[model samples]
Target: MCSRLRWTISSDSLRGLLLACLLATCGDVVAADPAAVGAIAVVVRNDSSIRLMTRDEVYAMFVLDRRGDFHPLDLPESDPTRAAFYMRLAQKNLTMMRALRSKLVFTGAGRPPQQLDMPALIGRLAADHTAVAYLPASDLPAGTRSVAVLQPSP
Candidate 1:
């Protein structure tokens, strides 16, 4: 009887552990989906003196159709946040943007923005007053300030 009782308790404990693990994994999956969240913010160094920009202005800046006093910094193409930012703000996918930039560079008409990963982007923004980049709202570092809040398109 005691052995049967021990086996039953062990089974219940194992079930509880499995349930806990499943719940934890689900939470991580939801958090990993950027689309499940709200919009990202376009930011510059805290000490940057640039004014807030409108959607069109930001689009032009990203596409190299216009120039601004501040240098533009881009997230690496493979970054999920970079994909979201371009889709929401620039109205272009990464492939389209890269093709356009390549054509411009080939013609000597424009140069592409400097590309960096999250940590490097944040560090550069903190040190370079002329640099601007977009990051997820949650990822914005303390030394940066949002110049524009980019909403996702309908």
Candidate 2:
């Protein structure tokens, strides 16, 4: 609880400072939106050739220690995002995602997620039907059907 309060204070102070700075210079703080920092879903292309999956399957695809649940994708051993991804998504601290990636890559466990911008990820999802990527609904790519939106796990 103490940590939570400290974090709240830190984030609030940072956000408020940013807002104050923005208001003093620009007309608004929207040039940098904090809401943009959240977990986006990693979606796959909806190819009939590939099997459809549930959230369980998707989560299982990444949760490394799960029995009989090895990652189906060929991930690098030094992926920098491996641990942080788990923390941000699994642990639900959005700020930690990049840090996790840095740690993974530095340790040579894996590489970061292939940087597919929203449009690219969506287009691939529509055509491949077997690809998975993280994207927010508000920033969804074209031609892809959202089976489920990624929510903060309670």
Alpha carbon lDDT of each predicted model: 0.73, 0.44
Model 1, runs deviating above 4 Å: 1-37
The candidate maximizing lDDT is 1
lDDT by residue for model 2 (16-61), tens: 6767676766543223333334444444444434344566655554
Per-residue lDDT for 1-154 in model 1, tens only? 6666643221122455867686754542212343544678889887788768788887878776475677787876556777778777766766787687778778978777777778888888888998888887766799888888876655
**Backbone clashes under 3 angstroms, per model:** 0, 28
Model 2, C-alpha of 38: deviation from truth (Å): 10
Which predicted model would earn the best TM-score? 1
Q: Which segments of model 2 are wrong by more than 4 Å?
A: 1-42, 48-88, 92-95, 138-143, 152-154
